[model samples]
Target: MSVNNKTVWLTGASSGIGLALARQLANQGARLILTSRREQQLEELRQSLPNSEQHQVLALDLNQPEKAKETASAALKNTPVDILINNAGVSQRSPAMETDLTVYRTLMEVDYFSVVALNQVVLADMVKRRNGHIVTVSSVAGKVGTKLRSGYSGAKFAVIGYMDCLRAEMAEHNVRCTTVLPGFVHTQIAHNALTGDGSLRGKEDQDNASGISPEQCAADIIRAIESNKAEVISGKGMSKVAPLLQRFFPGLLRKMLANR
Candidate 1:
């Protein structure tokens, strides 16, 4: 599961944890394929990495699942993706009651279906090679549901289940699947989250503003991968506490979340 010297394909490479991961992975000597909608930003990221010439930028819009899969599958023809980190996703900031149905679908498209699409595209090669690792960046919201996040939670929860099932079937093929639940990291996720009417939230949440840095989150994830962990929760304080409460004291957790 070590990323060192492996070929890693990462999505959401333009910013946040994905960007942090790109730097760390490249520093670890992994050849990289950086994917995101921001081609210019991805190019800048590539230039900033160590041994910059070793990495590549493949601009992809996860919103377009079929095109993304096709593009990634074509890249597979030239190079193998030893580690596929499905990190490109959007969040939601509207209540389930207020959320538009289309908003939910949009969340599913970017946060769940897109992950599935990319995984399927790369997994065929992994199974054939009998080697590979899939690291999906899910969220703490998926673990402990709260107000104004039904769509986001649903999509994140869906991906966790999908990766788990994928892990089960891929076990025989020796491919690994690791689901990472990261709490409110200081990223643009909140700012870019969808509102009830399908517009951007355009504001950072208080929790996000005070959360762990993306670099810290990325470092923890890299450690999880190297250790071959099945699941890892990356964060501090409430991020580390809520899930425990959810599993051991659901009623209390529900009451607490209702007030948030």
Candidate 2:
């Protein structure tokens, strides 16, 4: 599970935890194929990495789930992907009752279906090679329900469930699956979060502003990958406690979340 010299295909590599992971993985000598919606930003990130020429950039819009298979195929054509990181996702900051149906659809498309689509595209190759790793970035919301995040929580929950099943299935194949449930990390996710009407929230949440750094999250994620952990929850303080509480005391956790 050593990342050194492994070919890692990472989505959402333009910013946030993805960017931090790209930098860290590059430093660890992992060849990278970076993807996101912003080609310019990906190119800039490539130039900033330790071995700029060793990495490749393929700008992708995960929102377009139909193109995921083709996109993944192209990436595979260039180089066999030893690791596939599904990190491209969006967040929501609206009450479920008031949120538009389109919002839910969009969230599911980008956060859940797209991951499945791309994973399917590369899975056969991984099975054939008998060596591959699949890592997904989920959210604490996936572990527990919270107010103002109905769609976001649902999509992330699906990701966790999907990865869990994939892990069990891939075990005999020697392929590993790691699901990362990150609490409120300091990222632009809040600013870009969808509102009730499907418009961007454009405001940073107080908790997110004070959450763990993306670099720390990325480092923890790399450790989880190397260890081949089934799941890892990364965050600080209460963010770390929330999942434990949810697993041990559901009624109490529900009440606590209701007050949030």
Candidate 3:
């Protein structure tokens, strides 16, 4: 299950964990198909990598879920995809009561439906080949709901459930599925997070600012993929403990989150 020489289609490649994962995967001799809304940034990233000529870029907005199938077809036209990384997602920092329904719909479209749409396209090919991997970047919020992240958490939770079912279904096809639950890596996610009115928060959260580096998170994710793991949780401190607390001590975890 080494990714060496494997062709990986990675989304959200312009920044944050996606960017770090691209660098690490490139170093492993994996040919990448990088996608994001920023074509210029994707080109810059490609030029910065070793063997830059070996990689490809396909810029598109995942917000438009209807286009994902077409995008996936174009991506696979050049190379048979050995792995598909569903990492493009949006975050939210608003209470459920105040947030507009459109905001929740937008988040679900980008974070959940888009992944499913893209996967539906690529997965058929993988089943035909009987060899491929689907890696999704979920969140700790998917495991434990928290304040100010209702929409974001709901979307992530859907991802977890979908991936779980996908893993079971793909098991017979020998196509691996790995769900990555990252706590909080130091990235632009918080700054780009949507507010109640669907406007960007434009301010980084203190917790995210003090979180683990994206490089470290990328390394952990790569390792998980290589190991053919079903799931991997990456983060530090309470982020690592929150899931456990929620599973074993729900009452205590609920009280703690309530007081936060």
Cα lDDT tens digits for candidate 3, 102-155 = 999999999999999888868887999999999999999999999999999999
TM-scores of all models?
Answer: 0.98, 0.98, 0.98
Look at candidate 2 and tell me the lDDT of residue 111: 94
The lDDT for every candidate, in the order shown, is 0.91, 0.91, 0.93
Candidate 2: which stretches are off by over 4 Å? Answer: none
What lDDT tens digits, residue by residue, belong to model 2 across residues 116-168?
98898788889999999999999998998888999999999999999999999
Question: What does candidate 1's lDDT look like per residue over 36-105, in tens digits?
Answer: 9999999988998998998999998898888889987887787888999998889888878899999999
Candidate 3 local Cα displacement, residue 242, angstroms: 0.5
lDDT of 2: 0.91
Q: After superposition, how far is residue 6 of candidate 2 from its true place, in Å?
A: 0.6
Residue pairs in clash, model 3: none
Candidate RMSDs in Å, in order, are 1.0, 1.0, 0.9
Write the number of the candidate with greater lDDT, choosing between 1 and 3: 3
